[model samples]
Target: MAEVKLFGFWGSPFSSRVQMALKLKGVSYEYIEEDLPNKSPSLLKYNPIHKKIPVLLHKEKPIAESLVILEYIDETWEGYSIMPEDPYERAMVRFWVKFLDEKFLGAAWKACWGEGKEQEKAMEDAQEVLTTLENELKGKKFFGGDNIGLVDIAANFIAFWVGVIQDVVGINLIEEDTFPTLFKWSEEFLSCEVVKGCLPPKDKLSAFLLARKEAITEAAKSIVYK
Candidate 1:
């Protein structure tokens, strides 16, 4: 049996992050597709607390949470460390990763589900997050200096999902003029051979988001009718 196993949802950015890290590190693993709405017994067994996807099982030991799994992967794989050797540089990367996880992710999700005024506010908030990120990227090719690193991986989830949310919500927060650095980073990040090859198809992701939106809207309407 393969020593590594991954349980993930195809359209989940969290899952994508772990998958990308595993691939970049050249680790071979068994991939299991979990039905999130009806999560499999194995997935539940592996991640009892969160019951979430992107669970990485290494040598039969399970690791939950994408960022935590990323660190584990880097430490396990000796070559091509995703984090910097310098203590200060590594701290900077961790700082950005925490910022994106706590702040940007929620704002992006809010932008997706919000309506008229709420959505406008969400967009404004998302733009502010992007603006902050753009400023951080000034004179830097990647979030962790010249090469892609942990912060880049953590932030990439927002970049991918935010684009999908923008299409579904009919609003664009990462415009060229507003967030040029981030906008360019998105293109570059997605263009990497590993990411480009691994990404879920755009049409498929769009359909999934549209269906989710419709379900939410219908549920709201049903509540109003009731």
Candidate 2:
């Protein structure tokens, strides 16, 4: 058996993505929960640049960044590849993943966390981005075809985290009527046992996010008013 370990924060969508990948591949590994507010010495040492969670330590070697780690895990492991075999299909999956990360995910965060005009603008921008994703997912059960792939893993935030975020901040950008396709995708994504099992429990996740929202928003406001 190979030695594998994962350092992650439970509430992070990025961490959860890695978790799901490992689980889907049926790879066994040790899990270390990081305190994000006060990061661990090992975490900082392992991923000195980002100092972020969800670092995969494989055979005592460290890999940082969830997306990078996901690819590593897929390549290293044999079962249930996160990517498609075709080159063009692979590129399209990567494109959507990049779009999800660069174009929309940040907007979702701002829509939930930003205040006043900032929040309003974020909500508007998020809706537009989500509509694009919604269209991409129009007829597919999951991105990159029927089975969950890299694009779907990248989109894990929408499947589980966004609802708690919206609830915490009292803003909803992914409503059924407005984002029907995305909304349906969320429903189906969560229904998958592999994905659902990796998710943070709702009550616990809500409590954690509510506190996080309060802290981040208050800090943002202080900076603006200062």
Candidate 3:
């Protein structure tokens, strides 16, 4: 058996992505929880560039970046393939993954930092992103068609984190009536055994985001005062 280990933070969606993939693939690995504010020496040494969580150690070799780690895991494990086999299909999956990563994923942080008009603008931007995804997922059960695949896993964080941000900022971009497809996907993704088993508790995640939003708001206030 190949030795596998994962370094991650509990509340980080990026880390949760890898954890979900690992569980789905039936790959057993040791999990080390890292404190992001004061990262462990091992995590720092392993991921020198980003010092980020969701680092995968395979046979004692560390691979950083959650997306890269997901690919690595999918390739290394044979039982369940998360990515599609055909080149064209694979490219299509990658396209949506890239879109979500580049556009929607970071908008929550921006919205958290903005105030008044800025906040409203950020929410609009995020809503547009969700609208795009909602349309794309209109007829598909998952991004990879019937079964959940790499794109679905890659974009899963948006489903989970958006709710946390919505709760923190009191903005709901993904209402059932407005973005029904996306909202349904969120429910299905969260209800998946692999995903449901691994997610951080709801209250804990909400508290974490609430604190993060408060800290960002306080920092913005300090800057205005200065």
Q: Local distance difference test, per candidate?
A: 0.81, 0.84, 0.80
Per-residue alpha-carbon lDDT of candidate 2 for residues 121-176, written as tens digits (9 for 90 to 100): 77788788888888888888888577888888899888778887778777777789
**Relative to the unseen true structure, what is the Cα RMSD of model 1?**
3.9
Off by more than 4 A, model 1: 216-226
Best by lDDT: 2
Candidate 1, residues 1-226: lDDT per residue as tens digits?
8799999999988888888888888888899999999999999999999999999999899999999999999989977678888888778877888888777776666666666665566667767878888999989888867777888888876668778767876877677787888888888888888877667888899888888896754443322100
For the record, the alpha-carbon RMSD of candidate 3 to the native fold, in angstroms, is: 3.6
Q: State residue 5's C-alpha deviation in candidate 3, in Å.
A: 0.8
After TM-score superposition, the amount by which residue 224's alpha carbon in candidate 3 deviates from its true location, in angstroms, is 19
Ranking by lDDT: 2, 1, 3
Candidate 3, 123: how far from true, in Å? 1.5
lDDT of 3 by residue, 4-48 (tens): 899988888888889988998999999999988899998989999
How does candidate 1 score on lDDT? 0.81
RMSD values for the candidates in order, in angstroms, are: 3.9, 2.9, 3.6
Ranking by TM-score: 2, 1, 3
